[model samples]
Each structure stands twice: as C-alpha cells, then as structure tokens.
Target: MTERRPRKDAVRNRMAVLAAADALFNRRESPEDLTMADIAAAAGVGKATLFRAFGDRTGLLRALYEARLEPTMDAVKAGPPPLGPTTPPLARIPALLDALLCFKLDNRRLALALEGTAGAGPYRAANYERWHSLLKVMLEQIPGMADSDFIAHALLAATRADLVEHLAGQERVPPERMRTQLAAFTARVLGTRPTPGSNAED
Candidate 1:
C-alpha cells in the first residue's frame, strides 16, 4: 500500500517545532525545565499541535535529538576513514568514541534533557543501543579483544550525557582535554599505546 504524505502545514509545523525546541535548548542552561507549552509558544503553534505531532515530551526530544544528530550519523555511516565502515576496527573504534564524546559535548543540554527522562535510561535508549551494537561489532573485529559487549558499554559510559555535563559543566573541563582523556582511555581499553602527548592524567 502506498503511504500518504503529511500535509504541507503539518510538515511545516514539525519543522517549526523542531527549530523552536532547538533554539530553546541552546539558549537555556537547564533544558529539563522546558515544557511542551514553551516550545509550542515559541514555534507559534498550538499545544494540541505539539502533542499531536510528537505524542509526548520524550517523543519530541527523540525527534529533536535525531534531527540534530543527522549530519554526524551520516558521516559515521558512509564518510571517509576513522568513522566510515571502510576504516580498520582498531582505528574506527576510537574515532567513533571521539565522535560520540564530541556530540555529547556539543549537545550537552539536549542530551541531558533527553537522557534524564523517565523510562529513557541510557541502557535502553534506541540510539544508545545502536551505537553499542556498532561498537560491539567493531570490537569483535579487533584481534584478541575480550568481552566486546561489556567493553562497548564501558567505552560508551565515558561519554554519557550526564558524565559529559558533569565534566563540562560542574568541573568546567576544557573540550580538548576531555577529548584527549577519552582518546587515551579508549587506547588503553583497546590494548594500544596512547596517542602521542596523551596520558591518563592532565
């Protein structure tokens, strides 16, 4: 059966809601405080429209997060070495971790808001599972790697949105430094030497 496309106004409303949500998240320090009404008002749409389009707060967050993640996800799926499928697992794993860390850092507020929702814990989140499954596959490819599943989880834990927020917000860690630390940690886990000039300590 052929699927019917959304009406022009529905598409426009979705885009407007996404844009307004993005702006609100970027502008606010605590995105968790942002309500559906706030985003509806900002987008000049009715609250009913927001709920009808997104179903609930969690659905809206997932949509917005996925929209923001599209470019990075594209690069990871088919772009050149380090993230692309063509790269060696040994190299690609770290690159993937680095990319995830950067993404969390860049979208800290949105990440925190989404991750903090009830029933949306990191372990069960669809996006988290996707990355974990990909990382586990890569880890299995590397020679002599053990417990790829647990390793994938451990590696991803380092870049959790809550941890990122704590490090980048409360601790005020520099972005470069966090990247360096993550790279060094990933290297250690993969049983490889750390990159030049990178160690466990600052």
Candidate 2:
C-alpha cells in the first residue's frame, strides 16, 4: 500500500506558519519575546497545529533560520564562481568566509536567537557542518595549508552571530567596513595579502 502524502492545505498551513514566524522574528526586539501562540495567531492556525508542525520554539527557530539561509546555501553549493565548486580554493576560501559574515550580519537577530538556543551550539548545527566541510576541502587544496579543519573552524568563529552583533551593534561598525575587515582577516589566515583597496581602510 502507498503511504499518504500531506494534504495541500497542510503544506500551505506549514508555509504560513513559517512565514508568520519569520515576520514576527524580524519585528520583535528579540525572538524570546515571541511565543508559539503569537505565531499561530499570526498564521491563522491553532496553537496545537503550530506545536505539531515545529515541535517547539527551538525547532521552529531552526526551521525558520534554515529557510532564510536556503538561498545562500544553494549558491555556495552549485552556483557561480567564488562560491561554487568551480572557484579556485585560495579565492573561494575568502569568498566563503565573506559570504558567511555577510549572512550573519544581515540576519543578526535571527542568527543570534538560533545560535543561542539552549542545547544548540553552532558547531553542532547541520548547516555549520556543511560549511565547515566545504571550507576544509577548499583549504586542503591550497598549498602549505595545514590543519585545514582547525583553520576552517577558526575562520567560521570570526563570523559568529554574537561577535558580529558586538561589532555591528554595540561598536557601530558599518556593514561595508565589517565585510572588508573579514576579507582582510581571511586573507591573513590564508597567508596572502588582500588585493589593494580590498581592506577598505587601505
């Protein structure tokens, strides 16, 4: 016997819940301020449906975060040069790090909430592993680059949501300056001088 698929309305309701949660997350001062009930009401679904769909707040946050990151992840996986597999390692490494930094910067609040969720270390996250694996592979291709695993972790550390929040929020660093700084930093880790004018401050 064939198994039944989710009904069309069920799929639509799921999408609505995710969309409502996304909007609520962006509008609220903090994700902690939003509740499952609030999301259900906004999505026009019942509280039971929300809980059944996502399991819990952390699960919901993870789903929403992943949804938002899907586009960039797709680019890194199979899109154009600099991010895709076709790009040279030396160039791709910095591009990957820069992309991650920009992503965290753009999704500051959501990232902070997702990473800060109880029992959810970014290192253990599925998306984090995908990025680390890709970076490690790229680093291994570069000449004289030892400890690619550790190096990948270190580079990802620089783009952590809390660190990005500190620099962009409390320190008031401009987005362009932040990107340039990360580019320069990545270049240093890869033992290459950033191209002239890439550092923004140069």
Candidate 3:
C-alpha cells in the first residue's frame, strides 16, 4: 500500500500532544508518573494519536526534556550578566553556577534528567566530552593549575543536578545555600579567589 499523507488536523493534533506532554512533565515534580492517557486528555487528542506522535513514553519524555532544557542551558549561557558570554570565563565560571542554580529551581526534574543521561550513550559521550573540553580551555587561563582534566572532572561532579538534589533533598540543605557554596567552591577550584562579598547573582 502507498504511504498515507497526514491530514492537516492530524499534524496539528500530534504537535499539540507533544506540547502538552512537555508542559506537564517539565512543570510537575513527579514527571515520570505521567501516562499516555493523561497526556492525550491534556492535549485533547485520542490516546492512539499520542502514541503515534511519540513512539513510546520515553520518546515523549525525551521530547519534553528537550523543549524545557533550553531555558536552563540558555540561562547559563546568556540570560544573566556575569554568566552571559560577554563576561570573561573567570567571571562566567562562578556565574554559570548561579544561572544554573536558577534553572535548577525552575526545571529541576528536566535538569536532573539531562545530568543523568550525560555519560551513558554515544550522544551523551559527545556532549560530556565537549563540556569537558570546554572546562579544560577555561583551566588554561589559570596559571599553573594542576591536572586540569582531573579538576574538570571534579568540578562537573560537584555542579551536577543529581548531586544538588542529594544536597537539597536528602541532606536537607536549601537550594540557595548549596548554590552559594557551590559557586564559591567552583571559583576556588579554578585557581581564582572569589572577591570578598562580591555580588555574583544571575
């Protein structure tokens, strides 16, 4: 049989389904609990159409994570003063943590999901490797900083959302408190002393 062309309404319905799923998963604390029917009802589409748009629940979740993670990434990259590209890496390093801290507050679940996937598959390998390389470049700016590679690994480990979640949830530390120390500590690792009482809010 010949391939059937999707009707205009069908295309619109699929986009609606994915959009609804993205919103629900990103906004909720327990995104993993979302079901296809829940997504369809929210989208005003039939369950079959939801599945057709996304092959499985995982695909839907992935779609949602991608849509929402941009703000988190963008925040760290450009939303604020020191974190934005206009600032030197020395300032951006600590500011990245502050900007990312706000992102963690807004999109913690999606942020955790990205962090969880950072080292498993080939795609993740490429992303992780790229970030590692970027940190290595940042380290080059610091005179005589030992073992840039090792330090990069340590810095990444310290700043991850999973670690933050543990600190915030299990350790009962407030997110703001953890972010304060995390940003200050990250700057120290980069071989720069944070200026006393210097404001670095993103």
Candidate 4:
C-alpha cells in the first residue's frame, strides 16, 4: 500500500510552527507562558492549523524538542566515539551523560516544558524512555554494575531539566562546572575515575 505524502503547504506550515515555537521558547522564561494561539499568530497560521499540525500543546513541544535534539541523537546512535555504540561502556556512559546534560542545558525551557507537560511525564516520555533504555543497556555491559535499571534512572536524575534550570538559573552554576560535577558523579556511580581527556566536549 502506498502512503500519501503531505501537501507542500502542510509541510511548510509544520516547519513554520516549529520555528515559531522555537523562537517563543527562547524568548519566554517559561514554556507555560507561550500558548498555541501565540504560536499560530507568530507563524501567521490559524489556531486550527496549529492543532492540525501538532495535535496539542504537548505534541507541539515534542515535535520541537525532537527537532532540536536530532543532531545529538544522531551522533549517539551512529557517529564516532565516545558517544557512538562502538566506544567502551565505561567511556560511552559518561559521554552519553555529558551529551544529555548539555542538551538539556541548551534547550532548558523547552525541555522543562515538555517534560512537565501533562501526559508526557518523565517516566512515560519518549525521550526519557530512549535515554533510560540506552543507559540501562550500556550499564548491563559493565562487570559489577548492579541494578542497571535503577542506576540509569539515578544517573539521569542528575540531568533533569528542572534541576539543570535550578543550578544554571538560580545557583548560577557555569556549564563547565555542571559538566564536571556530573562527570564526577557518574564516575562515582560507576566506581571509576575518568581517564584524562576522556570527557566528551559539549
């Protein structure tokens, strides 16, 4: 069976919505501050078009979040070490954590909004599930790493968007410092210190 492609205008509308949403998120302090109507107006589209393109606020957020996270996800999935699968578990784990931290930090408001949205809680969110599953699989490969499931959850907790926002926005922690602290925390959890120059660049 053949599937029909979206009309060109549909594709253009989706892109415009995403771009407008991205801009809104960047300019606003809270994702809750922006609404579908605002995005629709910004994109020069009708509110009905926004809903048709994204289904709901949560859907729009997920679309924008995925669009922003795509590059990093691509590297983790297939690019070279240390984010790539071919890297040793010990190296790759920290690299992955670092990448996730940087991603949340870079997309602070959007991440916070998406993860906080109704029907998209952290446990059930697609992005969180993917990271947790990958981290669990990697942890399982390491000898003596007990309770990979819990460990992955615990490790990811440190990178939660709200926590990142607190440290970055309230405590004024520099990005490098946050990255260092997270690396140290990951090492302690893994019972190993990072090798020199082993931390992946943000």
RMSD of candidates 1 onward, in order:
1.7, 1.8, 5.2, 2.6
| Local distance difference test scores for all models | 0.89, 0.87, 0.67, 0.90
How accurate locally is residue 152 in candidate 3, as Cα lDDT from 0 to 100? 70
Ten residues in a row with the worst lDDT in model 4? 193-202
How big is the positional error of residue 17 in model 1, measured in Å on the Cα after superposition? 0.4
Winning candidate number (lDDT): 4
Rank list by lDDT: 4, 1, 2, 3
lDDT of 4 at 7: 99
- Order of all candidates by TM-score, from best down to worst? 1, 4, 2, 3
Candidate 3 stretches with Cα past 4 Å from truth are 1-15, 26-29, 46-55, 75-80, 113-130, 195-202
The TM-score values for the models, in the order shown, are 0.94, 0.93, 0.70, 0.94
lDDT of 4 by residue, 96-128 (tens): 999999999999988888888745457777688
Model 2: clashing residue pairs? none
lDDT of 3 by residue, 46-138 (tens): 888777877777566566655655665675556766656667777776766565555566666656665555455322632456556766777
**lDDT of model number 3:** 0.67
**Comparison by lDDT, 1 against 4, better one:** 4
